[model samples]
Target chain A: MSQEKSLLNKLVFSLQCLPGVGRKSAQRMAYHLLDKDREGALRLANDLKSAMDEIGNCERCRDYTEASLCEICRNEKRNEQTLCVVESPADVAAIESTGSYTGKYFVLMGNLSPLDGIGPDEIGLNQLKTLVEQTDCQEIIVATSATVEGEATAHFISTIVQGVKDKQVSVSRLAQGVPIGGELEYLDSSTLALSLANRQSI
Target chain B: MSQEKSLLNKLVFSLQCLPGVGRKSAQRMAYHLLDKDREGALRLANDLKSAMDEIGNCERCRDYTEASLCEICRNEKRNEQTLCVVESPADVAAIESTGSYTGKYFVLMGNLSPLDGIGPDEIGLNQLKTLVEQTDCQEIIVATSATVEGEATAHFISTIVQGVKDKQVSVSRLAQGVPIGGELEYLDSSTLALSLANRQSI
Candidate 1:
C-alpha cells in the first residue's frame, strides 16, 4: 500500500512541473494517466524527449527548430526586412497563429530582469543587436510584452538599433489600447486612458 | 512553418486527452513540455506506458493492480470480514488515502447506468456477488456513491445478499449530510432536509 502510494505521489510531483498545475490537478492527471489515457501520456512523453533533443534555437531568428534554421527563417518569401522581436518561442507561435504577420521573428527566449540576473547576454540581446546590424532589415518591431520589463527591453533594443552606424533602421512597438471587440465599461481605467490618449482617426 | 505547426498541433491534441485540459491548456502544456520540463514529460510518458502494460484488475478486487491481487487485498493485517464496495478505482484510492478503513474493497469500475448500456454484467455485479457469497465477510459496506444510480446499485446488492442462504451479512452506506464544517446557508435544500430528518441525538 505504501509502495503504491509512493508511486502515485512521485507521478503527481512530476506533473506539478507543468505551468499552473497545482497538487490537486497533478493528482487528477496522475490518476488519469494511470487509469485511462496511458497511451496518450506515453506519446506525449516521447514527443517531449524527441522535441527536447532535436529542437534547438534557429540560426537566424532563435525560434525552436529541429534543424539549423527554423522553417520561418529559412523561407525566402517572408519579409526579412521587417523583423518582429518577441520574448519567447510561445510568443512567436502566438503571432504565427494570428496569420496577419508575414515577416520574420527574433525570439529573445526571455526578458531582461536585472534582479533575476537576466541581463543583455542572458536574453541574447547581444545576438539580436548583431543581427540588426548585419541584416538588411529596415524596420525592427519590438513586440516584447506590455509589462514594465517588456517596455524597458523594447527601449534598450530601440537604443541598440539607433546606435548602428551607416544603416537607417526604424524601431516600433505594439500599440497599447482597447483590444479589438473589447467593451469600454469592462476595461481598466489605465487602459481606457491610454486608449483615449492614443485614439485613432476613423 | 506549417509542418512545425502540425507537430505542435499533434502534441496539443494529445495533451487535450487529460481531464479538464482544453485547447488553450493543451497548447500551454505542449509548450511547457518543449521549452522547460522535457525530462519530466519523458518520464511521465514512460510511466504511462509501463502502468498501462503492467496494471490490471486484482483477482480479489476489481481495483487496479500490477499483480494478481492488490496490496490492500494481499495485506493480512486488514479486516477480511469487512468489504467496502465502490464504483471506481479512484474511489478506492480516495478511501485508502483517508487511512480510516482497514477493510477489503470491491471496485465496480462503474455504476449501473442503464441509459449508457451499463448493467449488472458491465459493472461486474455477478463477480461481486460471487465474492460476497464465497467470502466469510460479516459486513458489506456499499460505498458506491450518493447519486440516484449509486442508491439503486446498493439496493440491488442488498437484495442479492438477502438471497444468500447461510451467513447473514450486514449492509451499510456512507452517511449523507452537511459535510463537517459545512455552513447551513451554503448547503443545498435536499441535503439540509436530509441532515434534519436523519439528525443524531446528542
Candidate 2:
C-alpha cells in the first residue's frame, strides 16, 4: 500500500524470498521485526550473513558446513562404509532426527531434472563418483524422495554403483508405500501398488 | 545430526525466530539459503539489518518510518483531522490498501491486554489521547481487529474521546458482520446477530 521506497518496503520485499512467504506474510514479518523483536531480527540478520559467509558444501558429502568436511563426515564413530545418499541437506537433517541411522550421508543438493538441464555433473554427481571410488563403502542407501525426479536420480546412482568394476557396493532405496498409520482407503493406487509389491512379512 | 556449533545449526536456530517457523521449516529454510538462493538470503540479511537500523516509530502515528514523520502523516493532501486508530502498523497497511480512507492513522502498536499487564501506557493510549486533543480530529475510526482485546481497546478509546470536555470528537468502530461474499450458513452466530441488528434497507 505504501508507494514510497522506504526501508520497510525493502524489508518486506526481502522477506518474501523465503520459500512460502507471500506479500502479506512479508509485511507482517517486517512489522514484527520493527515492533516487538528488534534484537531477534538483528540476530537473524547477523546469523544469515555469518552463515552465508562461513557455510559451504562439505567436501565429503556436500552438506552445509563451516569446515571442509561436515561433522558427520569427520566423526570417527560413524560408519563411513555405509553412506546414506539424500537429495538435499535438509533430507540429511530429517534422517538424522530419526536417531536410527549411524551411517554418514551424501547430499546431492537436488534431484536430477532433465528438462531443467540439471544432470549428473550439475549437482556434484562426479564428486559423488570419486567419493564412492575413494572410500571402501559396502552399502549406499538411496534416501532421495519418492517423486519422479528423485527416482530417476536414485536409478542413475544405482546404475553407476552397480557398474563399479573393482568393487561391489549394494544400493537400496527408501521404502515406498502408504505412510505409517495411514488408511488404505485414503491412499492412492500407486502407493498401494508399491506397498503391495514391497510387502513385508509379519 | 552434527551436534557441533556449526553455521548451519546457527542459521536454522536463527530462522526459527520467524513467525510460524519450527525446527523442520527452519532446517528447510537454512538448506534453501545455502543450496539455491544464497544471493537472495544475503539480500534479506542486508535488508533486515538496514531496515532495523533505519526504521523507527513515526513521530506522529507510531508507524514505522525512516523519517521523523511517516509518509501518510507528512502528506498535506491527506485529512489529518480524520484519524484512523488501529492496533498496529500492519493494520495501517491493511487499511491503506483499501484506498477508501483519505485520513491519517494512529497506531497503538498493540491492543490492551490487562491479563498480560498491557495497559494504556504500554500501548501508547495516553499518547493517542493527547494526539486526538492536540489535532482536534473530527472522527476516529477504530480499525482494530475483531477480537476481545481489540474490542476492549476500542471501547476504552471511545469512552476517553466521549468524555473529552474541551472538544467534540466522534469515535466509531469498524462494522462486524458477514464478509462481502460469505454464505449465510457458514457465518458465525455472533456475526449473524450483528449483521441482523445493523441491517439496512436498500
Segments in model 2 whose C-alpha atoms lie over 4 Å from true places: A3-5, A175-179, A199-202
- For candidate 1, the lDDT comes to 0.83
- Sequence-dependent TM-score of model 2: 0.91
Highest-scoring model, TM-score? 1
Model 1 clash pairs are none
Q: List ranges where model 1 is wrong by over 4 Å.
A: A5-7
lDDT of each: 0.83, 0.85
TM-score of chain B of 2: 0.95
lDDT of 1 at A7: 50
Query: Against the true structure, whose DockQ is highest?
Result: 2
Q: How far in Å is the alpha carbon of B23 misplaced in model 1?
A: 1.6
